[model samples]
Target: MNDTTTFKQSLTINLRVIGALLMREIITRYGRHNLGFLWLFLEPMMFTLGVTAIWSYTHANHLGSTLPIAAFTLTGYSTILLWRNMPTRCVSAVIPNLGLMYHRNVVLLDIFVSRIVLEVTAVTASFSTLGILFFSSGLMKAPEDIVPVLIGWMMLAWFGASMSLFVGALGARSEVIEKIWHPISYLTFPLSGAAFMLEWLPAPARAVLIWMPTVNCCEIIRQGFFGPMVHAHYDMSYVAIFNTCLMLLGLAQVRLVAERIAPQ
Candidate 1:
């Protein structure tokens, strides 16, 4: 076979492998129980909605006139739910599924990709459903520009997927990494731009925070959602370049993990 044909066959095989792994992951994680896979969307939806409700109630007296607390909470928390849960879910993905690696078609990268895909899909659905329901119920306005919102969402997903791969690979190589990441993630939460807007922060703080890829993506999403009502600062070029470089690094780490995995 020619080089092109060989590459096509390999790509096709890998895609099939990934598809199978996705199904397996869904089944394994959600199970055939109450709500089944619907929980994928429902779980995150419930979490985001709960947080929004608490924020709306407690902060309403303080934040009522300044911003739309409901919309702000929805957008910010949804971004957090989407991006933050990925690495958590994927950090030890390979360790639990090491036995599956005995199958020739199942590889470490497939396991990592499947988990990331599942997470991104679940959070995206939850975010969209919440947006639509809130808008229709008059609780929040519809997004002013959906194009940038979607681009921002995808960028966050890219960042999440890259981080997941890197963390998952590292976890496979060392037990210490798994323990370390949990606290590290919790510490990073406040800095993730989930609780405040760029405009709310001081100029120097904003300048420093915008360099975080998650913060940049969140700013873009809020800009698209709030439009003139809110001022959001972001540099898409920075987010894109950072995500690309991180993903490349993640792929390299995944390759290293694959080399170390000796299927029993």
Candidate 2:
């Protein structure tokens, strides 16, 4: 067969493999019972809702900002779930699915990709659903500019996927990753720009915190969301560069883990 034909066949096989894995992941995670996959987004939505309620009830001044509490909480918590859940699901993931490694086409990358896609889809859905419900019920206003929101969300997804791959691969090598990641995730949440706007930070803190990709992502998303009502700080170029490098590292690590698991 010619190179073109061979490439096409390989591409087709890989796509089929990914599709199968995605379906399997959904079924395995959500099951076929009540709400099944619906729970995927609903779980996060409910969590966000509870937090929003608490914030609203307590009159918690989020960094002394005047943004709508519900909208602010939704955007922030959803963003957290987007970046946080992927890595949480990925760490120590390979061992549980080692049985699938027996399949010729099933590779470590496929597993990671499946989990990442599942998480990104669930969180995005939750974010959108809550945003619409809030807007309709007069709890929050619609985003002023969607362009930055899309760009920012895509960037955050990229970051989450890459980090999950890297963490998942490393977890295969050592148990330490799984242990340390839990606390690290919790500690980082507050600083992730989800709880407060970057503009709320002191000038010194803002200067330093902007380097975090998640923070930049939050800034971009909120800029799209609250517009003039809030001042969002971000650097897309930095976010792009950081995510790209992390992706490269993640892919490289996954390759190494794959080779070790099933040598080519």
Candidate 3:
């Protein structure tokens, strides 16, 4: 076969492999239980809603005049659910599926990508449903600009997928990586722009925190959600450059891991 035809055939086979992996992952993770795959969306929604209720109740008097605590908490926590849970899901993905590698078309990259796709889809659906529910119930206003919100959501998903790939590969190579990532992921939660907004932070802190891609994404999302009512600070260029570099590094790591796992 010619080079172009070869490439196309390989691409088609890989796509089929990825699709099969996705279905297997969904069945493995969320089997035909109570809600089955529906739990994928409900799980995150429940977490966000629970937190929002507690925050709204306790801080009933303290929620700012500008943005309702429900709206703020929902936006921030939903984004957290999107980016935070991914690495956790992917950290041990390859080890359990190592036997599947015997199949010529099933590679390490396919395993990681399938898990990441599952996570991003779940969180996006959860976020969309919550936004609709909150707006219709009069708990929050509809977003002024959905385009930027979606762009920001995509950026966060990119960050999560890249981070998961990098960490998942490392975890497969070393038990130490798996141990360290658990604590590290917890520590990152507070600093991940989930609990507060960029405008609420002090000037010096804001300058430093904006360096986190998650923070920039949260700010961009809030800018769209709140519109003129609140000021949000973010740099899309920085997010783009950082996620791109991280994605490249992640792909390299996945390639290395794949080399180690290649059949003799």
lDDT of 1 by residue, 16-89 (tens): 99899889888888899988899999999999899878877787542233767778888788888887788888
Top model number, lDDT:
2
Task: Show the lowest summed lDDT stretch of 10 residues, model 3.
Answer: 57-66
Question: Mind giving the per-residue lDDT tens digits that candidate 3 earns over 96-205?
Answer: 89889999788889999988988999999989998889989999888889988999999999999989989999988887888889899889998898777878878999
What C-alpha lDDT values do all the predictions have? 0.87, 0.90, 0.88
Clashes, model 1: 0
lDDT of 1: 0.87
lDDT of 2 by residue, 1-264 (tens): 999999999989988988898888888889999888788888999999999999999998876788899988987899999999999999988888888998888888989988898899999999999999999999998899999999999999999999999999999888899999999999998789889887887999999999999999989899998889888888999999999999999999999998887532
TM-scores for all candidates: the values are 0.95, 0.96, 0.95
Ranking by TM-score: 2, 1, 3
The alpha-carbon lDDT assigned to residue 135 of candidate 1 equals: 88
lDDT of 2 at 146: 94
Q: Which residue runs of candidate 3 sit more than 4 Å off their true CA positions?
A: 60-65, 262-264
